[model samples]
Target: MYDFNSINDYLNTKIIGQTIIQYDNLTSTYAKDKNIFNTCPDGTVVLSENQSKCTVRFGNKWICREDKNIYLSIILKPIGKNLMISKFDVIGCSSVCEAVADTCNVECKIKWPNDVMINNNKISSVSCDFVGKSDDPSGVIISMVVNANMGTDEIDKINEEIKNSSTSLKIETGTDVHRELIIGHILNNVEKHYDEFMKQGTIISAVSSCIHNSAIVNKTISVMKRGKKTVRKLYAKSIDGEGRLVVADEKENEEILSPGETIIIYEGKA
Candidate 1:
């Protein structure tokens, strides 16, 4: 079993309230238990080994790579009543990518809603589901998976594919890194940002700084809308309070976009 010590150690270092769980695996028999396990306040994290099986039925993909990844879920009871659960996924992705870059000195990018890419290749994917909502405004549950287990050969192939698209820490610095430490660093950074966001309102200026530092701001890209036929190219101006991308066309007209909108942000003309 993977050690929960790292998570425990992190929680000890921070003022945030959290809970940690380490399990071998679980079945549907304990689904309720799993849900209850995450019902804590913000910063509560559930870490398990070979836990629940990933299935397409849940709109989740089981990305199996050796053992160089951290599969963990964080339960957060956000402070405000107006907090949008949808924004957490995007925020989590952006924060995680930034955390990885800052810790490893590698460049990373977010693929739309919740995927992280290193050197144009997929390194991590994040998915979330709302179990329930409280009338008094509780919090949200964010399940995140960070792939830190890619082998050198896998990294090489990923680098080749993303040479023109993305980058990874190992590829950039040519050094092997500890996946656990990376995961811990990411969690710590995320906690810091989450706290800041709770203190400050989610305005474009306040949040854009973090997003901009991650190289994800003001890029021209194409976004495909859900249940629609047309894909439009626009400059991703900023992300709004609702977590929608505020995109602009050639005429600088703006539009708000939700998930299922495929976006391609690169060095090409949009």
Candidate 2:
């Protein structure tokens, strides 16, 4: 397992007094573990190298890739209103995409709710779980898992199974990258965005500007409903005050979607 000190030391130079923890493996989901530390402090991060079997299962496949990606969860205890937990998923993906874009110069676009894609391929997948009392909904535990190791061969195999639906950094950048460094950059960016959201009210002007400057806006998208076989064409109307995708249909009717529902933004017109 990597040293927690090293992770903290690296982050300290970028962010002051950010608390972090490391684990060899975890038996529970990142959300479950984060809740255990919910009341701790802000910027408290818990990282595990390997996770239990149950934690790896996502639908039909195991989300764990062992040494291939950064498996991390963070607890960001923000004050004020309990912002929509769903928006954090967008914040997380946009942060990762910005970090990866800076490092690799690959055009990264966020696929609706929580996947990041580069050159029409998927480079990262993000998930978040929220735990807090209704009376005081400010406490939130957000966890994200990113795939940094999916290279050409892995992408080819995955594409064969799923058919042009997924991608990785190695395929777009044509080079191997360090998962830890990417994780650190992603965390930094996420912290910056989260801070901005807290300070600025969630009006369309403020939130849309942040998301547009990041790479999720103006992309043609397809929304994949949970348990459905087909994907639908939808334009990203705007990221809501809470960060959910406010997408529109061919008729320009808008719909607010939950983060758990699968969404894929196509690189080309659907």
Candidate 3:
């Protein structure tokens, strides 16, 4: 259980975690109970011990171990902020990387846009969902799931591809980590980076951070092309200036896809 009273003891933030709502279970923290955004203040966090039906990009099931990980969604009302929704992706991804590195003392890599990888296995993930229409939006939900303390037995339940690519802090470090402490650090980090982003109003810092710790660049990986169901093998060349991925296919055809254009996952041995 996340002790609400003690969470503030670890927090050192101005926003992005001023309020947190905890639940024992939910379908998914992003949509099901997201009505809280209407009333709650900005940067409110909706946390759950377990999600009965949690899905990642393209409806892929996220095997959430009850009470064994950090499953939370941050609600942000950016409509009044006069900011682009895509900017939150930068804050979310970079914040997670910084927090994990600080808390776990392990090198973390960003898989394309936002997923965090440790030694090639996914140890954490950040999913940023924009509310309302594409051109116009009201809010954004940054859902994150960090594999904090799950062991090998718990991770084995996942099927082959995911099982092989997923990992946890406990499994990698051979120790149990305090979940609340990680969440607290993440909240504080997000706020700090977010304020910097607002002050500068630029995302090049984020682009540099991702490129510096890229996981897919210089590696062969599978990317489900935009508006297509089938995944393709592509050699990711690098991330461009605007944070778009520059990848090349079998025929040496190069294509650039923005962060929202496609989903990148490890399908085969790279």
Q: Which ten residues in a row have the lowest lDDT in candidate 1?
A: 25-34
The best-first sequence of candidates by lDDT reads 3, 2, 1
What ordering of candidates by TM-score runs from best to worst?
3, 2, 1
lDDT of 1 by residue, 50-158 (tens): 4455431126454433344566666666655466644666667766776677777777766656667765565666665444554554566566666564555664554
Each prediction's Cα lDDT score? 0.57, 0.62, 0.78
lDDT of 3 by residue, 1-270 (tens): 777777788899877778888899988888753666678887888888998987765566776888888888887775455555446666677778878888889999988776888887888777777777656777778888889899998889888878988899999888998888888888987777667666665666666777778877888988886778998889999776555788998999999877777777665422
- TM-score, candidate number 3: 0.87
Which residue ranges in model 3 land beyond 4 Å of their true spot?
80-86, 218-224, 229-242, 247-255, 265-270
Local error of candidate 2 at residue 261 (angstroms): 6.0
- Any residue pairs clashing in model 3, and if so which? none
lDDT of 3 at 238: 77
- Model 2 per-residue lDDT tens digits across residues 1-270: 655554554452333127666776776446545556645576667777766642321332334555666677767666765566666776777777778877777777666565676655555666665565655665666566666667656655552544365555666667777666676677777777776666774434325534664444555576687778788887776777777767788998888877666545454521
Better of 1 and 2 by lDDT: 2
Clashing residue pairs found in predicted model 2: 87-243, 122-167
Residue runs of model 1 more than 4 Å from their true location after superposition: 10-17, 26-34, 37-39, 55-62, 133-138, 152-176, 201-206, 213-216, 260-270
The model with the greater TM-score, 1 or 3, is 3
